[model samples]
Target: MTEALSSLAEAFKNVGVSRAYGTPVKVVGEELIPVALVSFGFGGGGNSEAEGADAAGLESVAGGGGGGFVLPLGVYCRNGSGHVAFRPNMIALIGTLVPLVCAVGFTARGILRTLRR
Candidate 1:
């Protein structure tokens, strides 16, 4: 289990915010650098059992699993004025904000109820 966790930690060493930014591309004399939202998760577990008393035992069991995903947020591009700007994906922004908005609304509702009481 220690080795498994150690390897998982090592895997993340090279993954950072910079990984979310893609290399720049040039089109029509303009440079565009893509940016994205990145997230990752990892987990591990183990189990062991003894079959008998003294001098008798069974081998241990172990398992591990991990997964990750990324979402393209938008890109940084130079406008006609030659100034760099960020242009976001409306749908992605909405999707990211909806859950946050719902959480805030629920918290506010709970607070209002408590105040009234």
Candidate 2:
């Protein structure tokens, strides 16, 4: 199990910002670089048990699993005249920020109550 987790960690070390940036594609004299949000997780578990009267001792089991997701966040585009701009996907932005906003709101509420007390 340890070895499995170690390999998973090593594999993830290669996942960086480069993975979020797609190859630039040019269309109608405009270059567009698609961007994304990438996320992944890994887990492993092991179990050991003593064998019943027949086998005396020793049984072991191990399991590991991993999954990942990529979400399109939008693109950076440059026109023929070299004017560059970024366009974001509103749905992804909202999905990513909702939790953060809630956390901030909760912290602010706590601070306000503490100050009032």
Candidate 3:
């Protein structure tokens, strides 16, 4: 278990800021540092015995999982005047916003129903 936990910790370290920033690319006399929103997680499978259930119970296999997402947020680019500015990835931003908007709309509908009661 210690080894597994240690490995997970190392995995998180590798997934940190290093993955969020990319190698700088120079284009047309401008330098751009690509940026991304990185996210990840790890989980250890649960034990059926902890809940005091039968050894052959349905919860015997609590499968654990690890996953990650890297969404390119945009880049830090140096303009002609040497000022660094952030230019967002509109497509990725819109992809994220669509779900957010839907969630807000659903939440608003629930709140409106509660208020009407």
Best by TM-score: 1
Give candidate 1's error at residue 17 in angstroms: 3.5
Where's the lowest-lDDT run of ten residues in candidate 1?
Answer: 49-58
TM-score, every prediction? 0.73, 0.68, 0.71
lDDT for each residue of candidate 2 in 1-117, tens digit (9 for 90 to 100):
777778888888888888999999998999999999899887888777634633755477778888999999999999988999999999999998999999999999999999999
Candidate 2 error regions (>4 Å): 1-18, 47-58
What is the per-residue lDDT of model 3 for residues 24-116, given as tens digits with 9 covering 90 to 100?
999998999999998777787656555546654554545566888889999999978999999999999999899999999999999999999
lDDT by residue (1-117, candidate 1, tens digit) is 888898889879999878899998998877899899788888888766644423455467678888888898998998567899899988899999999999999999999999999
Which of the two candidates, 1 or 2, achieves a greater lDDT against the reference? 2
lDDT of each: 0.86, 0.88, 0.84
**Positional deviation of 18 in candidate 1, in angstroms?**
3.7
Q: Which candidate is the best by lDDT?
A: 2
Please say which candidate is ahead in TM-score: 1 or 2.
Answer: 1
Arrange candidates, best lDDT first: 2, 1, 3
